[model samples]
Target: MPEPTYRQILYASRSEAGIDVDHILQQSRHNNAVDGITGLLWHDGDHFVQVIEGPESSIAATYARIAIDPRHHDVTILSDRPVGAREFGYWSMERAGKSMQDGAVMLARLERRLTNAPETVRQAFTAATKR
Candidate 1:
């Protein structure tokens, strides 16, 4: 069967701003073992966006590798759609670490997951993002 067309994927995670992404990307090299892996890494306020493209199998397989890799965790898919340009332009891992301002990303996600946060808190976050 022909491979599925590549899909655009945008994901984010929050971690310490000082975290070294260079190290993370290098670690993934041997672990993922998939060829043509290339991408860009960027961070803003602790939020990260990574664009990776290639064979669907490679993408899916690498995601598994990323999840298991100790370098990163709590990954979230913010947006995904078919885009004309492959932002990453390669199949390698682009580890975009966190920024200090967006440090709340993990806390916010955890709040939603545990269902311990109040409605007002969630609403405030939503309102803040819209602006």
Candidate 2:
């Protein structure tokens, strides 16, 4: 098969009313993924990790929409890795909502990352709504 062109877009949004994050991430019926596109979305209660790959135009357009999408909170492009392979092939969009803790089980990874993140990121995180 030919190599794939990957462009990642990460965004955050509060969990919709009556909708579980896992359900939104695991289902392949989403209009975006249903088309000839492949990607994954992950939510850690505060932010998200999104990986989308396809033709450049579609990805760009989609990214624009995602930025303004009301369903999502803080929509930002984490990385637009070109020609990168999909990491979550099993899921058109995999949503992992569990707050993970290290083996010590002392601190939440999300909180740790947020605290450690640069001042700019921390500010953005604070402004963004959590899922």
Residues 1-47, model 2: lDDT tens digits: 77866554433444334445565554433756654456555455545
Count the clashes in each prediction. 7, 3
Top-scoring candidate (TM-score): 2
lDDT of predicted model 2: 0.49
Clashing pairs in 2: 6-83, 12-73, 13-73
Q: Rate the local accuracy (lDDT) of all candidates.
A: 0.49, 0.49
Q: How close is candidate 1 to the true structure, as a TM-score?
A: 0.51
Q: What TM-score number comes out for model 2?
A: 0.53
TM-scores for candidates 1 onward, in order: 0.51, 0.53
- Lowest lDDT 10-residue stretch of candidate 2: 101-110
Q: After superposition, which runs of candidate 2 have C-alpha atoms over 4 Å from their true positions?
A: 1-4, 11-28, 99-131
**Model 1 lowest lDDT segment of ten:** 106-115
